[model samples]
Target: MSAELRLASGGAPAPETVHPLSVRGLTVAYGDAPAVFSVDADFPAGTMTAIVGPNGAGKSSFLKGALGVVKPLSGEVRAFGGPLSRARRRIAYVPQRASVDWEFPARAIDVAAMGLYARLGPFRLAGRGDLDIARAALSRVGMERLAERQIGELSGGQQQRVFIARALAQGADLYLLDEPFAGVDAATEKALVEVLKGLAAEGRMVVCVHHDLSTLQAYFDRVLMINLRKIAEGTVAETATPENLRLTYGGAAQAA
Candidate 1:
C-alpha cells in the first residue's frame, strides 16, 4: 500500500465509540429460504476482523445484510451507535471483484472517484478536489502510477486495490470487504494485508470475508465464523479452533 494513502495525516481524533458495527438478530432470507438466522455480534473500533467459512457459508450474505444490499428477515444493524443509513458516509464497502464487470471501460482513477459520488449527491460530476482524493487513495494502494490505466487491463490484485482506493477516497471509518484475497498474487496479498493493518492502527475498523485458513493467524486479530447463523466471534485463538470451523462448514449451502 502507498504511504500517501495513510489515513490523511493528523485528522481530528476519532470519537470514543463503543462499537463501529453492531448487528443484533440479523436474520436474512431470500423469499422463504433463510440464509442467516438470529446472528448477533459487535465489531469493535480500531480492529481487524475476518469472516470465514466454507463455500456454502453465508459469509458474503452477512456483509450484504450489513450494507443493506439485502434486507434482513429480522434484525438491526447499527454504525457508530446510530442507524446504518445515517452513518453511511462513515462506512465503506468493497465487494468481490467478480461482482463488477472489468470490461466496463473505466480508468483506475475514475473507478476510485466513484467513492466520492455518494457524498457528492445526484447527477454531479467529480471535480478537481475529487481527483485529488482519488489520487491519494490510489497512492495508498500503491497504484498511483496506474491511475489512468483502464481498470479492465489490470491484474486481479490491482483491481482489488483500485476498489480499496475507492473506499479510502470515501474517508470512511469502517470498511467491509469481501474476498479481497481471491485470485491475487502473494505480493498483492501482502500489500493488501499491510493496508488493512494500517487502517486498524490508524484507529479505523476493517472487516473482511476471507477463505484461506493458513494465513488467518497472521492476517486478522479476530475471526467470526458463520454459516446460516453466526457460529462464533472472538480472537482467532479463542474461536478458530477445529470445532468451530466444522460447525460453520458442516451445514448446507446458502445464497450470497
Candidate 2:
C-alpha cells in the first residue's frame, strides 16, 4: 500500500474516484455542536484502515457519517466512484457489539443469512443455496459449530465472529466495522484480525473504528487520526507519531 497519498493540482488530492471510499468535507452533528467536523479522507481498496482517536473524538461519528447511518450535516461520501445509495449492495457494515440487540431471537446462521437479503428481495426467502453460503461464512469465522445457537447465548468474541460472518456472506467490496475487538477475548481478537487481514489481502477495503492504540500498527495498514476533525492520515508508522498523538489526545495523551 502507498504510504503517502498523492496530491493533485493546487496541493489538494482530488478524490480518487476509483477508490473504495472517498469523503470530502464530511461533517456530522448530534445537536447544537458538531461531533465530526469537516473531514476529508479516502479509504483505498486492499487496505485495512483504523480510525483512531481519544474517546468522544468523533471516531464513530465519522464512520456513521460516511455510511449515512447517521445523517451528515455537510459534505459528501462516495463509494467506488458513485453515490453511497447506488453502491449499498457492494458494502457491508457491522455496528458496535454494544449497539446490537443480542436478545433478539435469532440464530447465528439466521443472522449470517441476513446479509444475503439484498439479493432475496421482499418476496423471496432464503433458499438452500443461500443457507449454504451463510454456513460457509460462519465456518470462515470459526462459528459453524454454533450456527444453531442463539446470538444472546454466545460469548462476546463469538458474537463478533457471527457478525463478521454476516458481512462475509454479503461478498461486499467494502467492510466497515465499529469496535469489533472491544470486550472480546485475546483468542477471539487474534481470530478476528486474521479474518480481516485475509479480506484486505483479497483486495477488499476494511475500515474500523478502532480504540487500541498499542495494536494500531499491528492491526491496520493505514491510520486516520481524528479529534473532532482530521488530524493525520497515512501508514501507521508515518501517522501514529508521538507529536500526532499529543495533538490528538492533548492532556490525555498518555492514556491514549
Candidate 3:
C-alpha cells in the first residue's frame, strides 16, 4: 500500500510530506548506559508496524523516545515530515497498562477525557464537546457501557482498552502503543487488533512495541527487528525468515 495520504495544505508552504515517522541516527541512553544507538528508519503512513525484539532490547525506550518522554542522546525524530513538537497534536500514545497507577482516583470516562486535554489545554474544564468525543472514543473501544465505572475496578484488558480509547479521542494520525496485548485475554487481544487495523485502514499510522513473535505475521503489515539497533524493517515475507529470526533472537531458534 502507498504510504502517502492526502491532507488539506491550508496555505502552509509546500514541503515534501512522506512517512508519518522518520528517525535518523536516533540514540537513546539511560544514565551512561546506551539502550539504542544510531537507529535510522521510516514508518510509513497508514500501516500497522510492529517493533519486535527480546527483553532488554530497548523497544520500550525506542517508543518513549518517539513520544518525547525520553529525550534522545542524539539524532532526530520527525512526524509527518515535521518536528515532533510541531506535530504533537497529530500523535497519540498508548502506554503499557503497568505503567500507570490504576489506583488513582478517576472514572473510565474521566480517564478517556484526558485525551481532550490536549485540545482544551490547561486550567480549563471539559466542555460538552469534549464529553462527546470521550463518549465516542469509549464506544469505539466497546467501553461506553462502563463509562461510569471507576478505573481501579477494570480488568487488565479493560484498562488497556480505556487507554486506547483515550488515544482514539485524541483524533491523532499516528499511534504509538507499548505492549498493548501483554497479559490481556484472547478476546480482548483480538478486539484490539481489529481496532488497530481499522485505524491503519483510515490512513493513520499505528506502531506497536510487541513481544510475541508467533503472531507477528498476522498482526502487522511491517516489522522492525531491533536490539538497540534496527535489524530489519519490512513485510513479514521479507524479514521474518528463519535466518532473520535467529539474528533477532540471538542464537535461539524457538518454533513460532
Candidate 4:
C-alpha cells in the first residue's frame, strides 16, 4: 500500500488540471509585517516536495492558506487546478507532533480512524470497514501491534508514526504534513521516508514542512526555499545549493 495506506484516488491524478497545487499572488500576515508575500508556484502531481526556510518563514502559513485554515490577506490558493473549495476533501493535513497532546486518551487505532471523519461526518459511527481500514493503516507503519494502546502510552516516534497512519487513512490526493520527522529516531525516519516515497511512486502528491537540510536531497525530489517569501523552487539537486541555502536561511543554516 502506498503511504502505508492508500488514498482513495490510488492512481496518479487524472490531471483534471495541469497542476495539483498552485499559488498566485498569495499573501498572508499577522499584522503589518507580511508573513508571505505574493507567491506563485505550480506543483505537479506525483512528487514529494520539501518546504524549507528560516524559523519564521511562511512555510506553515503557505500550507494553512492552501487548506483554508488561515485567511490570506490577498491573492488566491488552488488545489487540483481549482479553488480549494473544489478539492478540499481530496486534501489531508498532518499537523506537527508538538502541536498535539500525547496525553490524550485515544488509542493508536482511534487516531488512525479519525482519518475517516471526512467521510463519516459527526453522527455516523465508524463501521467495520472503517476499522479495517484503520487497522491496515496502522500496520503499514509497523504499529499494528500497539493498535489498542493509548496514544499517551506511546513514544515520540510511535506517535509520529500513528499520525502518519492517520494521514494515510484519509485517502487524500494531496498530503500536507508539518514537521513529520521532528523528533524521531533514525530508523523511524528511514521507515517513514520509504512510506512517503511509496506514495509518490503511486502518483500522489506529498508535501512536507522539513527542517533537516541534511536529508533534503535524500528525501525530496523538489524543494521550495521560503523566507517570508519564496526564495527558490526547483529540483532538489539544482535548487538546494549552498548559495541558495544561505539566501534562504540567512546566517542560521550551514551546507547540508
TM per model?
A: 0.89, 0.93, 0.92, 0.90
Off by over 4 Å in 2: 1-17
Query: 171 in model 2: Cα distance from truth in Å?
Result: 0.5
Top TM-score prediction, candidate number: 2
- The predictions' CA RMSDs to the true structure, in order, are 9.0, 4.3, 5.3, 8.0
Cα displacement (angstroms), candidate 1, residue 74, comes to 0.8
* Candidate with better lDDT, 3 vs 4: 3
User: Stretches of candidate 1 above 4 Å error?
Assistant: 1-17, 251-256
Better of 3 and 4 by TM-score: 3
Indicate whether candidate 2 or candidate 4 has the larger lDDT.
2
Worst 10 residues of 1 by lDDT: 247-256
lDDT of 2 by residue, 1-256 (tens): 3536767668887664589999999999999989999999999899999998999999999999999999999999999998999999999999999999999999999999999999888789999999999999999999999999999999999999999999999999999999999999999999999999999999999999998888998999999999999999999999889999988998576676
Residues 1-256, candidate 3, lDDT per residue (tens digit)? 2335344378444467579999888899999998988888789988999998888888999888877899889988988878889998899998888889999999999999999888899999998889999999999988999999999999999999999999999999999999999999999999999999999999999999998888888999999888888888888779888787788778763632
Candidate 1, overall lDDT?
0.89
In model 2, the number of clashes is 0
- Model 3 regions more than 4 Å off: 1-17, 253-256
Regions of candidate 4 where Cα sits further than 4 Å from its true position = 1-17
How many backbone clashes does every candidate have? 1, 0, 0, 0
Evaluate model 2: give its TM-score: 0.93
lDDT of 1 by residue, 125-152 (tens): 9999989999999999999999999999
